[model samples]
Target: MNTENARSQPPHEPSGCLTGVARGIALVVVLPVRLVWDALAFCLRQLWRWVLAPVGRALGWLIDVLLVTPLRWLWEWVLVPVGRALWWLVDTVLLTPLGWLWRWVLLPVAKGVWWVVDLLLVTPLTWLWRYVLAPVGRAVGAALAWAWHIAGVISRAVGRAVGWVLWNVIGRPLAWTYRVVLTPVGHWLRTWVWAPVAAAARAVRAAAREVRVALFGGSR
Candidate 1:
């Protein structure tokens, strides 16, 4: 009976030790698994943050491209058509009559102004020149002619008086000098220079006659 009791006690003590070791192993495994799960959740959260950040940027870009671009394009389209319509209206309605008037009426009137200028201004100027300036020029010319004639008369009278005095006072002496001095000089020049020149001319004539005869074989 004592052996049976000791065996039972030993078995019970080993069972309790096994239970405690099982509980400790379960705690260790569960703690590591929870840590792994928490790390996985954190990684998933970071990945989702990275992906959503790019998606938000893409959405913002799409909004700007879709809304702002179309709005700007529509604005340009509306403004361009309005500007063209305004320009067309101005050209066709307003400027057309102005251009026509400038071409036909205003141009003709401007050209006719030259004719009016010729009639009103040029004709009067020509008449004034002929009527007023011609008489004045002729009167001035006649006065100048009269003045010249008076001066000529005075000059002629003075010249005649001077001539008479010079004739009386100096002409006799000059004539005596011409007779005394020039008569001998003229006779000497005629005797020396003219006689030599005449003899040389006769010699040249004789020489020319001999040369002609020699060249033409005595001419005969």
Candidate 2:
């Protein structure tokens, strides 16, 4: 068992030598690239911190001095007073007069026009609808209902009369003819004529059967 274990153990020296060679090669290949990356990062940080930041700050200050400050002053001093004066002028000149006219003249005129329209048109129309049209409509409706009732009565009476006439004139005669004439005729034919004919046929058939038996002899 000890010899078998020794035989199964794997060799390690060649693999260890190969691994060391690979690590050395990787270090040699990566050293220059790492140095170049570090240098580029340092340059970018310095450029942003010193050159680009100072330029941005100078530009912001110049813009504030040249454009923003003057515009702010103009808005605070010139535009505000001009706006206030214009608003005052408009209020005194236009709005006050228009308000006064609306309150004094136009309001009264509008009220008068509305009053005239209501008196002339609305009142008359209301009276006509209430007193005349409504009553007339009710009367017309009642008359139409009465006429319809009368028509229904007349129609019913006519139908009853027609039904009575048909029964007396046509139905009774047909019933009597069937009961008196056709029934007796049918019974007599069945009793006398049909019975005699049937009896004769039976006698002939029997005679034929006897002659056949006499000639041909009886069945086996």
Candidate 3:
């Protein structure tokens, strides 16, 4: 049985070491192809960079030349002339006639208004001053003088009572108002009127300085 089994298992065929040799040859052949592929990729990248650089610069220069320079020139030359022409047309055609109309028509109307205002305000004020306020003020002065004598006698008797009432009721509020609002308002009134005067004085001073510089060699 053992002899039959040995005979049935045929001898192992000779191993094929040629497959390993074929694999080594294939690896050696692929190495140069991979190197060439990597070299081509690098060259393509370098070429892309070189080409894009000039294209970007040219695009930027074209934008400036086409859009920016012409716009600036238009603003400086064309727009200015157009604006001046429009202004001249307005002054000659529209504004001149309007100004004439205003002088001829509207100015008389304004004068009429001023006359009416004077009649309403100044005439009444004058009449009141002459007829009512002046006589009433004189009468009040005379009456006050008479009352002052009587008041002095009574004040001597009731001085403490009047003083207490005024101190409690009126004096504190009056003092507070003077300190908080009236004092600042008085200061502001002086400043408001004086500031313009000061500005005019400063302008005069500047003109004098200029004149001095021109005449005296800036020594003053």
Candidate 4:
């Protein structure tokens, strides 16, 4: 039992020693980085608290004093007064005169011009289009439609007449000639001429074969 305990204890001692060494090395490696991070954080805090904050406050004060106050003064005093004066001047000089001219002079003249145009141009044109042009266009259209219908009828009649004439004069004669003359002639020529010629050709071939067989003393 003691021997076994000694062996196990030796293994655990080596592990503990290794653990201690690893921890010491890790602490040594991390110490400088931790110090550097802390120092940087402290510097950033001090910079924000002392330098940046006071400077931002001073800049805001300067802007308020220089830009914002002056602009507010200009808007309140200079711009407002000048704008009002210019508006009053425009209203009294230009706008008033223009309004008067438009109301009294231009309005009546424009109405008279419009009335003259309506009377001389628009009304006469409307009357012409309504009474004269519309009736004439309708009459011409009707006449053209009637003429077109009559022409279509005449064309159809002429086409049918031509077809009938062709069928009677040319088509019927050609059909009769083919049926009455050509068909019988073709049949007679085939039966008498072609049959005898084919038979004579066959006989000539047979006689030549026989003569050759006799001369050569062979079957073919």
The candidate scoring highest on lDDT is 4
TM-score winner, 2 or 4? 4
**TM-score for all models, in order of appearance:** 0.34, 0.51, 0.33, 0.59
Shift of residue 134 alpha carbon in model 4, Å = 1.4
lDDT of each: 0.90, 0.92, 0.91, 0.96
The TM-score of candidate 4 is: 0.59
Candidate 4 residue spans exceeding 4 A from truth:
1-65, 195-220
lDDT of 2 by residue, 1-220 (tens): 9999878878653577898999899989998899999999999999989999999999999999999999999999999999999999999999999999999999999999999999999999999999999999999999999999999999999999998999889988888988999899989998999999999999999888889888997852
Q: Best candidate, TM-score-wise?
A: 4
Better of 1 and 3 by TM-score: 1
Backbone clashes in model 4, listed as residue pairs:
none
Off by more than 4 A, model 3: 1-77, 92-94, 151-220
Question: Between the candidate structures 2 and 4, which one is better when assessed by lDDT?
Answer: 4
Candidate 2 positional error at 206, Å: 14
Q: For candidate 1, give the lDDT.
A: 0.90
Model 3 compared with the native: what TM-score? 0.33
What does candidate 3's lDDT look like per residue over 134-187, in tens digits?
A: 999999999999999999989886988888889878998899999999999989
lDDT, candidate 1, at 195: 92
Every candidate's CA RMSD:
28.8, 12.4, 43.1, 10.8
Winner by lDDT between candidate 2 and candidate 1: 2
CA error at residue 168 for candidate 3, angstroms: 36
